[model samples]
Target chain A: MRKLKRYGPPILLISPSLFLIGLFVYVLIFSSAQTSMTDIYTNPQFAGTRPHTFVWFTNFIDLLKDGDFQHSLKNLLLYTLVFITGAMFFGFLWAWLLDKRARFEGVFRSVFLFPMAVSSVAAGVVWRWLLNSNVGDRATGLNRLFQMVGLDFLENKWTNNISFGIVAVAIPAIWQMSGYIMALFLAGFRGIPTELREAARVDGANEFKLYRYVIFPQLSPVALSALIILGHMSLKVFDLIMAITGAKFYPTKVPAVDMYNLMTEGNFANAAAVGIILLLVVLVLIVPYLIHTARGDKR
Target chain B: MAVDTSITQRSGDTGRIVGKRFDWGRPVRFIILLFFLIVVLIPVYVLLVTSFKGIGDAQAVRAWDLPQVWTLENWKSAWQGTPGLPAVAPALARTALMVVPAAIISSFLGSMNGFVLARWRFPYSNIVFTLLLFGMFIPYQAVMVPLYRLVLSMQTTLHLGVGIPSLIVLHVIYGIPITTLIFRNYYESVPQELIEASRVDGAGMLRTYAWVVLPISIPSFVVVLIWQFTSAWNDYLFAVYFGGNAASQAPVTVTLNTIAQGSMLANYGAAMAGALLASLPTLIVYIFLGKYFVGGLMSGSVKG
Candidate 1:
């Protein structure tokens, strides 16, 4: 009774969140995993009622052979590369600049970071209009600017391009997130004591050499943290793609968007397969990071 | 942090290298900074200017141009909406009704959970935390199938009607991992002696938490509130899937997307106006509650 009393309130406080997370996160994970192995898509109504006959990974096999799924995976890879590199470069650059005592720091930081607050839908609308490709007298957006500058050749269809269409989408994603990554780097920079920089200067290290050796090395963890955050966000991208390119934009289709489409079209089995694949990829990236953090806690 | 950097700059201005007087690169550096600043602000500027333009001006003007004759007509029609498109105001209201409570309730629950997890030791608690932490990383796509089913089942069996209430429940559930993570980290910084002292006074766990810890938790409350509010307000996936495409049930994000991509015609001016309207809440939050937002982002990313 004493033991129960001692532990009771703590457990009581935690149980509601614990129970909901278990039901929503874990139990649903199991159910989805089971659905991926079944033939439920052949009949749409079988989704929520009960599990259908086990198909034993046929959906995944078919998915591998599917052209659009294959292309979507390629798009994701290309998107990740562009988004992470672009966001990190600009983020680190801005952080470095701001760290060097820029004027109007508050105004600049607020303007750069404000994009983080805007919804992806709103961002997509703005960028879509800004990248509009009308020409000559009817020209708007960048096309008009290109014409004014006598560089009309630089203007193109933007998100409507057949090749490298996903790259166009990455521009807006980078714009929205680089400020966040900048904040992360700025925090990392601040966490380093001023004494360290002074010591480096006393050791005959110039500003460039000081950063190259001491500062850059200390920032690897911050870079890794940015990578994981941006990587996963780019992986599960749905809203931005749909908002910018619309649902049926074949060139820019991604797994998350494809999963939504399949599920909405009553193809639950295939959707579940895509979901499981995404889960595996995310687990591959995140589980090790979780373990690393847990071990850090022990220290 | 910015203050420390500025202090360093002011001290550095005292001619550390006395012989090196030709500093021709300063303007170039400022130019580069200004270039990026323009690149970053152009889309927003375009949206703002376009919203003010008359429909013909919206179509005709270069994206860089300020509206020659700024008008409220676009805002009026955007709020009133066309036949096929829905007004932005109701969708904003529905989203608020859903997002506000979800943000508040989830943050409260997370604070309690975090208090227990951090202060109350138990066997396998670390393992439990590790499991819960995994929830933060899973793509919503991976869970969408089963989550959709679960919501449907609740609708039929528990008689929980679809739309805002269902959305609130989903946000609260999914919000657990991050909220718990944030608050647990927050509570970890509280001196153990305080809790022990409260206990020595014969205060039970709940009373100790309520009287001792809750008072000092205001800063964390701000962080979690801003974090949850922004995310719940910005969400498009859960809103679209669960809330459905119905005008009455739709959140502002969904409504704006639909209006922007209207079937018969796309009205860029109205779309820009609606997009700006939809973005105002979170934008306002950032402008006013920026400190808390930065706090949440720092804490949220540090452990990741």
Candidate 2:
């Protein structure tokens, strides 16, 4: 009772949020636990992984044999590489550009960030239409433009093309994101004291060398944080893929879409397995970063 | 965190503001900026021209055209497409319902939780706090399988109302990691004496939180509010799935997807119209709230 007295108010105040979280996190996990035994596909009955079912690793084995799963892995790896590198480079560059004391800094900053405000699904919708190649209304997307200019050699169903579709999907990803990267970079830039760069110049350093030696090192923590954030965002990306190609397209598949497909088809066991693996990958990147930040230390 | 390396111009102690003298880089900077704008505007310009063009003009060899021939036909049809109901308005309303409450409650609770964690030294505090922090790195996908079953089970066993509540709850979970991180840092920077002074009086927990913490946290509050608004308003994954069959419950993201899903030959025009209309709320808010957004992202970046 005494313990309850001290905690009553906070518990009562936050119980709604806690209960809400518990329903989503704990209870849902509990429900999906039935998949450990039953054959989700053929048998339907709770026959269990008994006399007939001795294959512990077969589902995972079968998953690897599937070409779509393999392609999705390749797509995620390539997309994460291009998407993060591009988003960071441009995000930083835009931030750097806006760092100058200028009359139109605010206007330009807002202009860049405006894309981020639109949902990825919506952005995908617009971009998908822009990329369509139908002769009906000419569908004047990028692919269409290339075709008209006799750059038809360069054109294909870009979103459906296994080799180039990732890039096409990533184009909008970068567009929606470059502003966010710009914002983070601007923050890091502002964090820089004015005297440091001037001092670098006094030491006879050029802009390139100065940034390489002085400014870049100081911004490491923020840069790392940004990378982690973008890494997670890129890996977990869904809406754009769904919008541009719906769920089942070949070329641009990622793990989130794969998981969504499995779950939608009611293959909860395999979906759980996939979700667990994806979680592990995200954790591998995130855990160390949190440890670094939580050491009660700052630059 | 200081990145300002412009020490060459910082020589004068008494008279010079930080680069008050016109560096030659200023006008050059604007010209440089124009080049950047063109790169950014290429797709936007293409989308714009194609939106205004008729079918033949859309398919034209030279696609670029000034909007000389103005026509309200696509807009009229789209607005009139589904009887009296239009896509953009209802989506906006649904988006607002999600954004506003999520922003307010998340920020408010976030600041409180942050304050308690940062200031007090109760034994089990960090453990509880860390459990919440567990959600920070665990991609929602990992826990989502368990979580999805959890929500559905609640609908059955616990008799909880589902759908929007379940989704809003999930969003709140997402919001906590970020919002708490922001407030934790912000409150740490806040002076301890202010709380001590209030406690010396007869102020209890609720009063101290209301009277002391909330007023001083206006800036941090604004920061979290904008962050929550964007993440919630722009959410695609949660809305598409957690929101069920009712079109009314769907936010702009889902609605936009539905519009694009159907048959429309005027792909360019409809897409531009849908995209433009969907993004309007955030753009309008941004125009009014520009300064706070920058300050918020910077401060939040440091917290992370």
- Cα lDDT tens digits for candidate 2, B1-304: 1223233334343233655555666566677776766656665675555556555555444455555576664454444445423455666676787788878888877887777766543456665666566665666776665566556766788775555566666677678867777887788887988878887896766788788988888889888888888778878887776776435667777777776666344445655566667777776776788777666666655543
How accurate locally, in lDDT, is each candidate? 0.83, 0.69
lDDT of 2 by residue, A238-292 (tens): 8889888888787788878988888787666677666766766787887887677
The runs of at least 3 residues in candidate 1 whose Cα sits more than 4 Å from the true structure, single-residue gaps closed, are A47-51, A133-138, B1-26, B58-64, B263-265
lDDT of 1 at B99: 88
Across residues B48-124, which tens digit of lDDT does each residue of candidate 1 receive? Answer: 88889875564554456787788988788778887887899899999999889999999998898888888875666
Chain A vs. true chain A, TM-score per candidate?
0.94, 0.83
For lDDT, the strongest prediction is 1
Looking at model 1 chain B, report the run of 10 residues with the lowest lDDT sum: B1-10
